[model samples]
Target: MTGKPKLYYFDGRGKMESIRWLFAAAGIEFEEEFLETREQYEKLLQDGDLLFQQVPMVEIDGMKMVQSRAILSYIAGKHNLYGKDLKERALIDMYVEGTTDLMTLIIMYPFSSAEDKEKKRAVIIQKATNRYFPVYEKILKDHGQDFLVGNQFSWADVHLLEAILMVEEKKSDVLSEFPHLQAFKARISNIPTVKTFLEPGSQRKPVPDDKYVKTVKRVLQMSF
Candidate 1:
């Protein structure tokens, strides 16, 4: 924690943005090493630098680490973004897992063929915007809390909020039906560090392929 933390990931936000958000939110200094090509990432995999052979690896406390959620939780716990107690942590973990499931469905849209992508995209969009979103909506409604865990913001909320923003970029209206999540996202997006991370100057990755976006938009249409 004395020196700057180092993060390894692609320029995109696929699975690493919440880590970035955690660093930014904690006002922690970190260095980013973006893997620009599949070849570079493969080299690291072959070298065994990554335990999981993945892009989102991190070096903190002089030790390398993998798994996005673990890193997020670690950073959150360090920075007090995690819940204050064991019960709160349990609730936070539940919401975090739900967000991960939601992320899994959306991330799969790009892995299929352009034709297949659209077909699968419709189903994913239905689940994300309709099926998946409402689950959180009901939870948020029942909890009647500002965040997923308690009154204060938690890392789980950060993860879920970032996932929501990722979807909103492709199909902006996806959250139209979920007023609770809408309010939740708005609240988290206003955090000082998050606000800075979202600024135009902080965005390093270009808009990725529109094929995925188009597929996502099509999915939002729910036409299949």
Candidate 2:
């Protein structure tokens, strides 16, 4: 909390991307140490930096944090993005959990085989438009608020916007059927902090390409 939070992960948008989005939404600047080779990841393991032998470890407030959810909850709570009370926090958690589910699908898409990519893409788009987006759409509509939980900009909004963009990367017109989500995307994208992150030079990573996939697989010793 004194200096910027330093993030450890591969150079692409994996589990760490949501952490980046939360920091951006909270208007906090952070640094990232991208793991491009197996040695780099193994060094973290050797140093006991990774709690569960994973990346997405963050150095913040004198603690080395791993586990995406734990890191996200801390950032959100510290930055007042979690919620006002337990009830509100519960709602935020519900919305964010759903968004995380959708994001998991998109995150793994690039790792699929060539033949499976199309099938994966279809599933992603289908879930986004039908299962996921509709839920947020209804939430925004029923609440008649600018955000998903309590009508305030919180972690759920940040995660939802991030998930929306990820889905759109697979299908440009993915939000066409979800009018409220379209508006939500526009609204959240323009927040001063988020806007800066969306600009060309910010730390926001792009959708994973072949090189990103290969590097992650190599560094993590993953087959898929």
Candidate 3:
């Protein structure tokens, strides 16, 4: 067996960051190979390494996987982060879809120049905080627990933390109105496996940076 899973992606965290944090929260060891240039990624895609011809792929037990959410659900199932039963699974799935709704906007910010990205970012920031985040806040508040599904921590909470960080980066005041969400983020971050991913010097980023400057235009339409 592979000692650990192998993940391939652009250097920027992008979709892979949440997967990384999931692995950490699950206490799994994995290795990563980052794309240094667009040419490297294209060559891998052309070679048929990526099934959908996109990145944030993982190799587990010699079988390759694509789509970040699929990988996450797989890992959560294997690692017990998924929750205790079918009822919790239903709720987890609902929140995962919600997080994806917020994530789609965050991932689109880098497809253009700085000015256009900011314009879209501002609009997204407003909608995410005002409209979407409150839904999560109420879920947390209604549950009256440290997590989204059941009384135990679930992958839904981990995924929400990822979305929260992205919104917080754009506007530091993103969580100002959502105390339950703020507390939810704190619980996710307090996990030993998750803490490293959020700590200073970690590769986690709210948006693509200098390393991904050449890579964004290609991944802009990514559904993963």
Candidate 4:
């Protein structure tokens, strides 16, 4: 594999930023391809591998990688960025999966009508607050530390912590209800590597809502 991979991303804040942060934290060298329009994005898609044909995909050693989480996992594993050991890796996976679930909801909200979006966001937040909070609390309690896993940092911590920041932008004090999670998010944010990555002008816009038909409201109905 090449020392530096080719990274495809958009220019606004969205799902891809976490991957960008992941690579930056790992100290990986990568060339970023930024697209600003449909034509440019489509042109690259035509040449991208057929499996997913998606951006935020990483091209490493001439191999086309797709799916955001998959790309994060691959990079984390390759760079020894997962965790300290098997147990820690498992914890990281748990946090990553939960964060993914939360992000998926956020991605769907912006595409719906304002009414539907408001309603959907409320439902998502309610469920997450009631059902998901305790689970995460237990995780923090189990770990007995600020990190989701071992002493060192991992992809999960970066992903969840960043997601919390994004969510809080739209929903104030979302993590306040869960003190452990609140502390956890703050702890990850304080890391020098993560702190730098979270700084301004580093994120790519999320996949456009117009591109995906069946608006956010539709997804919310099915999701919640």
Candidate 5:
């Protein structure tokens, strides 16, 4: 019998959720540990005696891996989820990197005030929407592929879909303005694997509660 995968994650809408969705879509049985507070995470670390100093670590048959993107790529390769060919795989990686860059900016907007965030959002739009969008639009147009890769689903598509959702949530109608990206997101979201993984009741959005936000706010206040 094969050993199950063990995954550690925080409760929030972030990188870890993407990996969780992948595992769920792949029909892989594994342990998911969701920590909502620093105290809970510390206790879990003590109890498990884990080696890593971060959440979203994965232990595959006792071999531990960290870094969300690295974990996603590793599992994608192992599970044949990187599309049909080497070129397709490269394209998948390309989009994954692109999405990561955008998401990094999007997440920061929420922790900041509206004035600062609006300025940042404008810059992101000028660079990401104008420059990056064209690059992605050309890729989707040339690839003639439903997914970011060849004719199949890949981690890249999932990451891109997540990025699109986040951008929408942050009040950017970049997708509507760019039809190709909109198409890409819609196509990826409808994948049989993705659909099954996202089935109702399988998982819940893990946005942090007000108390957790307040704690972080207090800590930042002290630091600054």
Candidate 6:
């Protein structure tokens, strides 16, 4: 990858947001082609760029990469963010997988009906506080490490930080009860590269609003 990697996705944060987070963590600059219209998305499909017919296709290392996990793994490996050994990588994978489950809920929250939005919000908070946050809190407490695995920064930390912020967007006080996680969030957010990404005018996307929802639905030809 001589030049910056180019990412293909919508203007909002879908599955591609984590990819952006990983790139930021790696201190790698990239370009983006936001698919704002049905024609644009159809053109990508017509060109056969999307092997899985998905928008998160990334152009990196002389290849067009599809599938969010595969793209993330490649970037992580290239940047030495995966792990030192197979055991450490396994631990990172486990942590990343857990965070992915939490992220999936947040990603789909915008698509809920007006009536179901409140209910869904409550569900997300419940899972974050009770199911997810506690697990990470314990991991940090037991390991006494700044990161989730091998006492070093890895893909798991990047994904977890992203997940924490996304949950916080839903509920401001979501992390008040988890002291370890609160510290971890503060530490990760202050990483020079991540701090820059958090600033305004950066590539970080805001929460999905009506326009974002409408654009994504139209581009993907979704009914609900």
lDDT of 4 by residue, 1-224 (tens): 44688876554345566777788777665777665556665676676553565556678866778788788888899877798778878878887888788777876576577669778878777766776666778888886976667766778777777667667766787777788888887787778766666677544334445543333223223353
Instruction: Give lDDT for model 2.
Output: 0.91
The deviation in Å at residue 168 for candidate 4 is 0.7
Model 4 lDDT at residue 23? 80
**Tens-digit lDDT string for candidate 5 (1-224):** 25888776644555576777677666676676655456765665776644565556788856677778788888888888887778878878887888788877765555656568688878667767776667778878887777667667778777777767766665657676778888887777677767766568666354444554455445224241
- Candidate 1, residues 1-224: lDDT per residue as tens digits? 44788988756555676677778877787888766555666677877878975557889987788988778888989899878899989988888887788777666555556778667767767768776678888989997988777788787777788778767765788898899999988888888877787788774344456543454334233233
Q: lDDT score, residue 18, model 5?
A: 72
Model 2 regions lying over 4 Å from their true place:
none
TM-score of 4: 0.79
Q: What residue runs in model 4 are displaced by over 4 Å at the alpha carbon?
A: 1-3, 48-50, 203-224
Worst 10 residues of 2 by lDDT: 1-10
**Which of candidates 2 and 5 is the stronger one according to lDDT?**
2
Candidate 6 deviant stretches above 4 angstroms: none
Model 6, span 94-197: residue lDDT tens: 99999999999999999999999999999999999999999999999998989998888899999999999999999999999999999999999999999999
Best by lDDT: 6
C-alpha lDDT of residue 159 in model 2: 95
Question: What is the TM-score (0 to 1) of candidate 6?
Answer: 0.98
lDDT (C-alpha) at residue 153 in model 2: 89
Q: How accurate is candidate 5 locally (lDDT)?
A: 0.69
How many clashes does each candidate structure show, in the order listed?
0, 0, 0, 2, 0, 0
User: lDDT by residue for model 2 over 1-224, one digit each (tens)?
Assistant: 45989998988899999999899889998888889989999899999999889878999999999999999999999999988999999999999999999999989888899999899999999888889899999989998889888778899999999998888888899988889989999999999999999999898998789999999989989975
Model 3 spans > 4 angstroms off: 201-207, 216-224
